[model samples]
Target: MPISDVSSLLPLLVAIPLTGAIFSVLINSKHGQVLTGLLAALSLALVICAILLGLPSEGLQSTTAFRYPLAGWEAPLGIALSLDGFSALLLTLTTFLVTVLTFYSAYYFSASPARVRFWPLWWLLVAGINALFLSADVFNVYVTLEIIGLAAVALVALSGNKAGLTAALRYLLVGLLGSLCYLMAVALLYHLYGTLDFAQLAAKAESNPLSWAALALITVGLVLKTALVPLHFWLPHAHGSAPAPVSAILSALVVKASFYLLVRFWMEILAPAVTNDALMLLGILGGLAILWGGIQALRATRLKLMVAYSTVAQIGYLFLLFPLLMSAEGTSASQLAAQHQSALAAVCYFIVAHACAKAAMFIAAGNIIHSLGHDDIAKLQGMAKYMPLSLFTFAIAGGSLIGLPPSAGFIAKWLLLNVAIDTGQWWWVVIILTGGLLAALAIFRVLDLAFIKPEQASEQVAPDNWQKVPVAMPLSGLALALCTMALGFNADLIIDLITIGGGE
Candidate 1:
């Protein structure tokens, strides 16, 4: 395919999964699983092709943004889908993770009847994620956000137990509340600007009360959806109670869909209206989320809950980008631009790292539950002896979460620290380091119990009673965990891609 034609393929990223979802509803259970898996794999391939074709030829100065107008109509009249460096990277990440999890889900749900409802909901969630990343208008973003939240809620309810149903209900309420706030912001922005296009809004937005109101509404809505700190009460319960694959999708991509929008709103569309005090306040909230989430993770009694709380903490790191981009009064324009690019790159790296590591950890936790029929932290004693692969997967992913050397998490934090220091924001450095230590403590708490001697284990399961975990489960998780480590070594490609379109 020619580079220029890549833009035309953008809609396929959304179409394939949506078609699969509709087809899944019509098919029988066995065929639906097979069809879902094949369509997901195809979506991953399409994303890769689009990304390759979309990249600027070698020796080019920057990336070209690909825009596809629906039915050949331009923005402000018809929907426009765009693929820039930021959106392209996220599209690839979303598809890659979805493909791997689809494989895991196939095996994970082989014996369960929930497989029927799972395939369609899973595909709908994938469609929502792809659409949200590609959407170039605020109204479309809100539409996609609603799709993602609804699909995710239905998926969480698939467990069909009281806890799962209750968690799903709470997730539904939280999602509805967040969407209401976001829709209000969208309406306010439209009323103020008379357009929904991102670029148009950015160009027209001013430092006025209405713009500030829109920004505030956007922040509250996205913050609640992203589950950052005080508004994060809904996440742990929803993510921990859902099935493992559902939990992986929620923590890995669903929350990220909202955060991605928040980044776009604060850093791009509403940049003119962003205030220094607001930036610093977001940073402070991020810092608090880091500390509070880590402490809660340490106290979590269940394996899945611990990983879910860790997600809350990792999200905090991304918010620090807001304040880090608040240039000092005397900084040169060139220097400020450089700092902005660096901060964007760092947060992007953190998002990718957390998605991979957290997904792997959740899958590993699912494997443990499958093998031993429970996920109680105390009862996980000596798990390493029998379930070495899953335990190893968990530990390696935990290492990344702790920002250990040679892990993608470390590279992301290193970039963030460099930006903080370069921008003379030294206080964030202290918070970053403290958060790492707290993460290490929480991770080690799990590792310590898992690696205990079998004979000395207080609640070791009998050998004969251990259920056999399918090979695909642990292998799939290990693959994602290794991707996190691999990213640590080869960040230049991602950084270069991220810098395309000038890191906007």
Candidate 2:
């Protein structure tokens, strides 16, 4: 297969899903279910095509990236789509999660009127994520992030309950504030560099007052969007109250989108303007996020909230890479180069691992919620008796979160530890280990609830047949967990793929 043919699929990635979303909304009243299902399948097919085309053939060491400017116009004037190794992997992850959540959504909302609204918004979010990952310009990135935020807020509000609506409103406000900050940065960058194109800006970027202001603005905005601590006030309410499948994708993929853009901008366009003091500050915040999020999770009384807070903690691990990556500077020429690659590779693996594990955990939590008709941990005693598969899935996903052996999280953390150790940043090592222990405590709290046998029959609420654990539900969670664990065994594949276009 020609690389060009594969590269051509880049535009279709954004187009197909957006088209599916629109078509589903139009045909929903008459044949919404069938039409939406078919469209989702079609979108998934396009996603697979893009990924397969993006991958290099055997014996090939590098894959060519495809860039297509809209309307045959070049950047700084026209919009463009571009995909390389990093974006391709994220696109693949986004599509896979959407496909799985689509299946899970069908089962989850089978009887709810909300299904009509869910499919379209879900695909819209997918489209936004795809577009953001492939976007080559900062302005286009802002546009895509808006789409993602709006779609996600709509999904959260789908529950139509007071809690869900309130949470959605909070999320929308936070998202808008984040976007505003990011837009300010984009404006500043464009004004300074005369172009918003990432490559163009990267080449023209410098350490100057205007650039530093943009950096601060972008950092604050992205950190808020990514839900890094102190700014993460809205995540638990939003993720906890949304539907299971909604929560799954929100925690697993939505939050990661902002962080992804942050990484891209920092590494590609703003590295020259970034300072060591700033990087150190980010690492400190990450360490604090790990501790704070973990403590909150351990204290959370609801399963979904616990999982949501776990996302906060898990995200901290990704931020730890910034300091480690910064440490590469001022080193020997060869060692500096190697350190940069390792840091990128480590962060990428950590992202992939967390995506799978967190998605699995949320799906499983959804199952447990469905079976018991509640999400309270205290009321979940003896749930393992009825929802064994979900409990098992939770255990596996939690094991990954705890960085246990033979899990993707383990491999990611190992890579991060080596990077920190090699750079003599051993303080982060203690933070990492402590975060793991806290994660373990948080996870086992739910497991402890699962192990308890209800003393009275009245204590357990018997689920209706329709509310019983669907075979597809647990399978969805299990499949993600298995994939995460499988990554541990095939770490080299992840390392190679993440490093594809991440070169000097």
Candidate 3:
């Protein structure tokens, strides 16, 4: 299949969500949720269509057939949209998460008027993500980034509490700053290459002061948005204070958007200009992020904040791929390609695992926090007696984060470790193992409070809303966790898909 075969349908991915979001605003409270669900389903269906029709067996080796020019104008003058293995995987992940989040939100916000407001913003955010993944132009990505940032900030403020408001303000500022840097880079790239298209720029990019400046600007902007360490100061507050579903989206998908862009830039557009020393610098930052973030998570007093900080740690693991990938270039020509593909597959798998695991953990945390009326771990005594489902959900999610057996995280970690050893990048091995152990400790610290036998089995009375916790709520978390665990067995499917698009 070529992109032209499905070019007519590509716009629908962006249109469906944008329309749904606007329609949500006009609909009454009673129908808002329904509109959101329908739109999410339709958007997800569109992603499936993209995977099937836009991705030809030829892969990215010759992309002329798959770059769909928008509004009858070709690149350098008009927008273009392209899909490959990488974009397909991310689009699928985004829609799947949105679908689950939509359904879970219906039950989560059933009692509040907030559901009405949540629907529109949620749909807009989905629109942004879908657009970002499909976009073939860097300028388009910048536009999508603003859409995502604004929508996310609005969602965070939906709680309407002072803390949520404050967090949203900080998030807005940080996002704007990142956008400015990125916009500057885009301008410079356009000026230097006379094009905004990824493929075109890749061919034209040079190892010069201009390219380096652009790379530096783009990297800083993306890392800030990605919440990479030193720049991750705002994440805990924003994630912890936002509503649970919002938190899940922010942690699992929002940050990944920036990271995805970074990957595209580093691996494709800017690859010729990047040096090994620069790549090594990124890997070292990742190692530090793992250690520092894990320690912060362990020290956090609230469960939600702990989960937020854990995101910081897991994000670090994603960066470890850089060194392994860089080192692969040194192998013999016969083996070099295989090593590259393996490293790519490993990192992609890790990202998928983290998304599923982190989303499950946050959803489960939301439930526990709601049930206990607070998120303080020490106050979770005897949660096992009444909230066993949530406890189990949390445990499964946490286990995945810790790279436990039969989980996606375990498989990803295994692949990464093997690659590190094979590539002779043994330093990352220590960081990987240490990060996993620290994750285990952090999760256990929270679980330990849950399992503590209080003076009485029923010492903590169920909150008003917990008298009969809906099967849907806890099941939502369980569903995501199950997906993560199932990935351990189904990795081959993902690898094949990514390999096609990656053309490795």
Candidate 4:
């Protein structure tokens, strides 16, 4: 489905929330917060409705766009909001997760004195992220990315603690620098191609030295922002210190946004031959991060920090797709073998799977934090009695992360394994399994500690029920995680849409 209708409302889907943010901030009161939350929910609900109504009959691919002129002009000079299968998938995730996160935050921050402040900034961030997903031009993407980054920092600092404040500042500096590098790369692309539109640039980019430099800078900038290995120094600290809802959004979507940009810029705009080395570089670092992060997570004493480091490990799996996509045998080639790049499917599948599962894990962790008043893994003995939802949710999500059977993660891993074998490159398989095993070690460490019954009476402060975060919230994420696995059984559905018009 190509975008034939400029009145499809994709731009409005993003704009409504941005406007709602200003409306909410202007009326900052208890009534205002409640009203804003309701408005935010309604706007997102409507966007999802629009998506549902427009979901392609074809199943796997869908797209919609609004070629709105900024004051009345043509597309080459103006801008447009285009939603392809990939962008639509991202949009659905953003809206679904925002709705859940908003609901969870209602209770997660209920006891806090500053609920009003959270809603405005949080909604604004969601708007920026949605806008990022919708933008078709490089400059628009950069602008939306800037807004998302600033609002994210504000959300992080809302905790008002030393750790949160410090992490926010550090994340800001690194984030801005990365943004700078990406902006420069985009500028170079514009100068070279005379176009900022992704589609236009894709056709124009050549495997020349100047284009190659732009590709390298863009790839490096996005990888840094995505927090792949060595460049991920700020993520664990920021994620560990933020409130649970914030952590969920950060891990599930925010960091992934950078990765999405990498996909858009590298796999779409730039010629494949221009950046194979960088992709391999990313994959190598991703493999290392998988093992290193999992082991560090296993050693962490605090639950939130443990979860944060777990993020570090899970992120590594995403990068594994790079090398597979970039080469025939970890070496660059002008032409790629179609049979060798099954890793693209694996990457898309894993991202969808991880988004749902990680969101659940973070919300569940919040439930534990709220109910138990602490996140120390050592202190959580017999927590199943009080935090069953949290424990079980973590387990289910962890199962997915570990590539266990009947889970989406497993489906994704199997595909990547097939790709490696098909290409006669089995070392990547070794890295994948090692990562999965280490993830298992980290997961069981927490579970074993949590399952241990204690002698002393660690009084449970929360009442038995309503004790965990809202049932609907975590359940939504869990349901999505299940859908991710269901994708395997329904492979025909996604395959049909993966290459729909403009899904390149």
Candidate 5:
């Protein structure tokens, strides 16, 4: 495919899923699932095509950034969807995950009537995520963010239990508050610069009081949505009480959407207004989140909640990039630029690694809960005997979470450690190592119980009491987990794709 052909298909990434969402509402429940799955697969193909066609023929030079103006109108007056290497990488990640989860969800909600509602909302959430990645303007981002939050809330409520309903309500309220804050920032920027386009805002933005205010507002809003420490009170319950596939999507992709926006604002559009003090503050919160989330995970008695809290810890790793980038302030111009690129690349790797690892973990947890009728950690003794695949899936995914060697998580953390060391911020290195140790403890806590022999187990359940889980559930999870390991071996390809469009 030619670059132009691939660029023309960019809008379809959003359109196909959005159309599927609408059509799902008008179709039969079973057919809706089929349609949603097919559309998600198509979206994934589009993303793959974009990456292959947009890659330069030789070297590390970036391909041209493609922009598709809606209705022949460009930004400032009309919305434009963009397909640069950054957005392309995220789109590929988003579509790939959604495709796999769509299959997992088909079997997950197969017996439940909620499948009727799940398919539409699932596609809606996918549409929103893709749109947010491609959005060239702040206002469009806010619009897509709202779409994603609302769809996710609806999906969460589909669980139909009191706990699920309560968590969904809390999620809705928190999402609205975050959206309001982000909208305020959008309005402020538009008023000051008379434009909502990111490129325009970046060019026109000044290091002034209003810009700083907008920065603060954007940061708080995105941080709240991303479920960073201190403001992350709503994430655990919402992720834990939701259905397994919903839990997987929330941990793997939903939080990343908001974080992606925060990165764009902090590192690109608002770069001139960003201060070392602010970056350090973000790093401080990230470090605290790693410790606090890890402690919470260790304390969690339920398997799902442990994975949910672990998400909080994994999210903390991404924020460390901000402070590490700040540490390059005194370097030579070439060195500073190189450090910036490396830092961005590291965060990108972390995001993809976490998405795959965390999604696999949640699906594995879901499979265990599906088979055993509950996710109580203490009662999971001899899980290896009854549900070896699910337990193994969880352990393998957990290994990635713990940054074990030859896993994607190890590569991400290694890159981050190098950046910290190169920038002379050895303190972050300590935090990184400590967080990994804490993660290992939390992960192994489950493994030790699951792997115990039935005869030697402390809280063994009867073999006859276990229910049969669908074969697809554990297999899907294993596939995602293996993808994480595979990523560890192919960092160069991902890095090449990410560095496209000038590594922005």
Candidate 6:
């Protein structure tokens, strides 16, 4: 692969879609919607090509920074677009999932009235995600993050119900609060470090109150955004009440934006100064999120809401990588750094697995709701008989969620577990396995609905437009699930990417 652009292609990934956001506004109403989807698809395709055009190893290859010096300035003064292995993985997922999400929304809302407003907001969201993944500058990251919040709000509002409106409002309030905290943290960093770019801050930062405060503020704000445990009150209602595809994005990627920010901050901005105590705190929270999310998901009345709760649980798993990454018990610094890359890579892998699996589950639940006129798990019977594709998709995604063998989920869990044990963090191992077990419980609850005979005879199934759902959507989920399982065979390539990734 060759370099993508001589001067700058990195910013183009973000600018092109953002430009589409403006251009999409000029489109005639219905035409605008079509154009928006096309633009999103095109932008994503270009990003994939550009990403592929980077330095490669295998499995999780990434094209590093496509440096475009803003106004032809140098590194410290100009903004750049850096696409490391992790970012590339996420960028690809973001685009691909957004495309699927748009298509899914088309049929999901086809008979519904909200169909008219869904596409534009959905496209802007794709744009936001692209920008968020590609952004390198702290201030620029904030701009993109705000766009995500706004677009999500609009998407939520498209549901056009009282519950939707109320949920959107709650999301808005928390979103702004998180943004403010992040902004204040950014301000603190700029005040202390005098540079908003990650590389510069990294070089300048030392152990100090300002740095700790800024990092704490940023981490807490992001935790709020990711809706981790105590700060996650806004998520269930917002994701549960939104349209199906919207819920998929909310569960799959929206919350992940915050997680991405934290990872960037950790890996690029503050690797050394962050203490073991902080990592421990994150692990503890991760454990709670896992347990609480699983229990709540199992208890949810609505299937969509149950998936939302599962997301909460999935987030807990993400944080367990921290302590494992921070260890130097046996390994030297260089090896630990290399291991850090792999751990971070595992996070990315987990993200992709979760996104595909969760998307399928949401779509499956939507199918059930569409056919049955409700999503209550208790009411579902003979779903597998009626909707095999959807059920199979659900099962595949569930397999990934539970860390079952041969799936990408298992590979990710296996790698992280090894890191934990090597570092003498047995607690993390216990927590992860417990989380997996709880995930098993939640997944089986839904599957149980389909297998068990109805207590009393149930009414005949209603006519369903499930045929309208694209074969591509569920198949895409299945492919991801299967790929995850297959990932176990390709650990070497994944580890290679991670080895080079931290440097990229």
Which pairs clash in the backbone of model 6?
54-63, 406-485, 407-484, 407-485, 408-484, 408-485
Q: What TM-score against the true fold does each predicted structure earn?
A: 0.97, 0.95, 0.95, 0.90, 0.97, 0.91
Highest TM-score: which candidate?
Answer: 1
Residue-level lDDT tens digits of model 5 in 301-330 = 999999999999999999998998784435
Q: Which stretches of candidate 2 lie over 4 Å from their true place?
A: 29-31, 57-64, 328-330, 452-458, 461-466
Query: Per-residue lDDT tens digits of candidate 1, residues 1-504?
Result: 555587878888888888888888888768566666676667667666666665775423333357888999987998998877787778888888988998888889889989888988999999899999999999999999999999999999998999999999999999999999999999999999999998889889999999999999999999999999899999998999999999998998989889899888888899999988999999999999999998899899999999999999999999999999897888987988888889999999998999999999999999988988889998877888888899899988999889998999999999999999988889999999999999999889888888855665644677776798878889999999999999999998678777767742
Candidates' lDDT values, in order?
0.88, 0.85, 0.85, 0.75, 0.87, 0.76
Measured by lDDT, the strongest candidate is 1
Looking at candidate 2, the ten consecutive residues that score lowest on lDDT are: 57-66
After superposition, candidate 5 runs with Cα above 4 Å error: 57-64, 327-329, 456-459
TM-score of 5: 0.97
What lDDT score is found at residue 282 in candidate 2?
A: 88
**What lDDT, from 0 to 1, does candidate 5 have?**
0.87
Q: Candidate 1: give its CA RMSD in angstroms.
A: 1.6
User: Candidate 6: deviation at residue 502, Å?
Assistant: 2.2
Which RMSD values do the candidates have, in order? Answer: 1.6, 2.1, 2.0, 3.4, 1.8, 2.9
Give a tens-digit lDDT track for model 6, residues 1-504: 545452255666666666666665666466566666666677767767665556455432223344455667655677766766666667767777776666666556656757566665776777788778877689988998899999998888787889989999999999899999999999998998788887677778887888889889999889999999988899988998888889888888989888988987876687656887898788889889999999999889888888999999999988887776676656777887667766776777778778877887887777666666677777666567666777777887899899987877888888778777767778888888988998899888878777554432145343352343556555545554565566667766555544444553
Q: Higher TM-score: candidate 1 or 5? A: 1
Q: What pairs collide in candidate 3?
A: 85-501
